[model samples]
Target chain A: MRRALTLVVSGMVAALLGILALGGLSAAATATDKEAANEAKSVSEAAKRAGKKDPYAPVVYGDR
Target chain B: MVEQTTGVGAPPVRRVRDALPLYAVAAAVTVLVLAPLAAPGYALLYDMVFVPRQPLSWDLVAPAQTLPRAVPMDALMSLVTQLVPGWAVQRVALGGAVLLAAVGAGRLVPTERLAVRLLAAVAYAWTPYLAERLLIGQWGLLLAYAALPWLVRAALDLRAGRDGALARVVLAAAPAAITPTGGLIALGTVVLLVWDRTRLRRSALVVGGVALLNAPWVTAALVTGAGGSSDPAGVAAFAARSENWAGPLVALAGTGGVWSAQATPSSRAAPLVPLATLLLLILAGVGAGLLRRRLPPGTAVRLAVLAGIACLLAALGVLPGGAAALRWAVVHLPGAGLLRDGQKFLAPYALLLVVCAALGAERLVARIDREVAGVVLVGLLLLPVAVMPDLAFGGAGRLRPVSYPADWQVVAERVAGEPGEILALPLSAYQAYPWNPGRVVLDPLPRYLPGTVLTDDTLRVGDVAVAGENPRLREVRRVLAEGLPVSATGVRWVVVQHQLPSEVDPATLRDLEAVHEGPFLTLYRNPAVPPESNPPGLGAWAVVMALGAALLVVMAAAISALHRRPTAW
Candidate 1:
């Protein structure tokens, strides 16, 4: 009975830890996503204003 | 798999656990080298065209059939992008490649000591070819490069009749998920297998396995009629042009390829020869000399011959008689166009050199005291990073990725439900984006608008253009020369990229209505358009691929299970 109790508690603890770890990972990923979104918006606005040709396009290769 | 020592001075890898530390170090270094990728908002400059905004689909894999180059990696990336953000996927993939190459190279080394294997891995994974290609954005080819060591190890293991060798071969062939280079390597491996008559059964199995792995791309190429013509200038453009007769030699030693000035690293550790690269060259020479005494005579000879052939091929453009030979081969041969960039063949040569250096390092340790050997090995391993710091993470200066304009996102969103084909205007294959100065980004329009079939046939290779028929080309030309007339052209929507050079003024179109107008792009809609037709048998092809991939995974899992059983090993 005592051994069973110990096993059950340990299993619960392990599950809890796993969930916490996963939550941390997701949190980090979310932060990165938000940052990327903000940067994309900024760059897009800049690109709209600049309106220059794609410098890395294949046509440029022909020129080179 | 059981470790079998076929050649002299061979030390067995006791267990898989013994390889873990080296792999860990490799993983850490890989992460370090690509640290810039971990940065927020950065996207790779290369083919982000298929960066997944929506769920993965048949459209993602179908392009392999029609595209000239079968880049299975793009499909894989698309699948990955479904879960991970697009900005992070390239960095993760490249880091994974570096780790894979390191582990694979470590396994190929026949040395007893762990240090030698680790050092060899560093040499193999951190070559000038790797840096140059990564900088140029040929990650698919690099995936194949990373798998080369594993392929060799598996081939050697199979020859020895080691259990689970077939499984290793299957795993190594996984790189076929990215590039057709694995198939090419497998072909060479089969040739090697042919040399040993006793390994005939294993060789046949290896061939079948390789064929199965390569089926998606191979079938696609066959179905699309992909590889026949060669353009002389196109062939010449990618040919390995050495600076001098010894140019290829110097490049292999340290500097880089002879082709593009951009291949040079952003920063130099030394003006002439990076101290680390020179050390590797010296080590390789020493290793070669020791090969006859330490390793099997035949194996040693084969390694030297392979390296020599690679060097010869790499120098073919710049050498006195080489250009003529290369020209002849390109003109006369059927699939010789694939070898246009002959320098890529040097990857195997680099592999052999690393193995040789590892063996030589082992010999040096045996002769000298531990203290002296330790100093020498550590210095050699660290010198590469010291000499070429930019290669560590910055990709020689192109680490940050620029985002597509929000106009692209908005346009893609607007066309999400459209069924008809959308034609992109200023129909140039490659365009330099002003947003990211001096860097080129492939058309992101198709990537943004997943719902529609985007048509632009400006992609070319020398004089031989891509798979657009004369009639279609004529129609496109006419549409571009004259403004889009709704009834004449079948295109439902015309996307005019105002920033690029275009023959016709999109605003001048009479019948087409301006549906959406933005700063950089203008979308015009046609009133009359036909319904979409299903691509013949493409669904069937997708099913076959799905089944084939599932089968491989099942087989691999079964083999792994069998390997785990005590009696089986």
Candidate 2:
């Protein structure tokens, strides 16, 4: 019964969780347009501190 | 009788009652599989479309999703998409699992009806695949695994009442028609059934059934490019991508992504999985030994052995102790030949071992640890999950935010300031367009670019022979002269990712154009474009995708509620 309840409640929670996930995501999606100056500043500072690991890091043949 | 309906439509009442549990399980699986769409990257579809065929060409055509050996099961999805109106092929894979799992559980413990139903839910709920967090985006694997329990159940069904030879043959052969791995699993299982029973006729029939089912896919592969068409050297190079023994297993066990190294606590727990897996293997061996004398005649011992072999194969690439084993058998195993990242075989290995270990735990639960059954059984079941990094549950998904690479908005904003057509390289996060109905030379994609050669090894710029050699300069010159380059035909801003290293300079080659720079990418102007030429802003496909998705959700919900459930079965 507990297992069954876990499945059921977990399922319900998954559904409820879906709303949160959706809200969190879509909010972020539009918020993407609202580029905070602070984020840019932090990103620039961090780039200087650490190396720039651009998203597309190709597999350098020799590096591999 | 129980209102028997036949031929084209809804199954009879008795059949419905018998399969009710499967129905619930199927529904749950369908939900979980499609749920990834709510996340970014449309990751479920993206993985399905791209990972199998990484490194895009200028045209960005999606041929890799269906190329090469043509996994029989995934090919069936192309047919499913073609024949079955309005069905997303990915969901069908999950449906297949839910279906077979239903049958398998139904057959194994029919008396435990509620338990069977619950297990079906837990099957998805707690599966390593479920927790792996990444979508089980492989349509072929889904189809292949789905057919498993059905085959197993059919074997058990043969043991029961009426002669079930034909059904067993069909079920056993079904996997062979799906994915090769799945087909292998099916063939192996059928071989076990036959070897144990000494039933040559049965074995032949099952094998024949699979061959018959796969006839079209095999023919198609031959026509396009079968395994023969594969670049032996290229494939070798790809498969040559080496990983540690534990990599695949660690990744697979981390199915939920909770146990991922990126997850906060992953490093602490990751090293322990090999130990747990080893313990489970020993337990499986002991379980087999203890039950050897009291087995279910032929099939039991044979199946247990086959399952053992499958586990050994997966572990050879995963377990720390398997180094000696992998070295000894590396030449003889098919994994050495075809299985790249022998670690990917980890997921399959985990499934096999978990099942075997579950059987062991089942025995232990019954005989010695009935009092601590929950502790011991759940512990054994969770060893892989706990050790896995992906299974971390951060409230719901990940605790940290996942950012799409080269944020589209930033790219678009940079383009707005430019006075020419914006041609961009392939964004790592999403597919670029070619048809924005605008002057963006490389719409979102550039398949329209001629001589967009794709070879066996490198994905894009297949024309380039090793990176250092400068044949690419000639190709680029040719491309610049041709329609493939955005700047070739009067587009000013030639935007490319700075990360994509090319030996040639954008300014030096063309001898013309001013350049605008974005924080992420560089935009070069085509001096050829007459003054005051400006391409329209980025096109509206993302909007189209958004609208199409909203409509699909409504359609799916409506279909779920209004469509008569009986017709679906």
Scored by TM-score, the top model is 1
- Give lDDT tens digits, candidate 2, residues B1-569: 01112112455675566566556655544443334333333122212331111212211221221232333333333334445422233334444554554344333322222332333333333444433223323445555555555555455444432254445445445643454455556656655554334556655655555444544333333333112222222222222111224544443433222211211222223465455446666655555543343334554555556655654554444356555444444344423333422322333333333344444555655654333444444344334323432322221232211223343345444444543333444322222221111001112212211112221122221121222112333344456556354455444445555433232344443544435455544545566764443222222222223224323433443454345344544
- Each candidate structure's TM-score, on Cα atoms with residue i matched to residue i, is 0.76, 0.52
As a whole number from 0 to 100, the lDDT of residue B230 in candidate 1 is 51
In order, the candidates keep a fraction of the true contacts of 0.13, 0.01
Model 1 share of native interface contacts = 0.13
Candidate 2 off by > 4 Å: A1-64, B1-34, B38-41, B44-46, B50-67, B71-79, B82-87, B95-136, B155-165, B168-176, B195-199, B216-269, B275-295, B308-337, B343-352, B367-569
Candidate 2 CAPRI grade: incorrect
lDDT of residue B562 for candidate 1: 79
lDDT of 1 at B477: 72
Lowest summed-lDDT stretch of 10 residues in model 2 chain B? Answer: B433-442
Worst 10 residues of 1 chain B by lDDT: B1-10
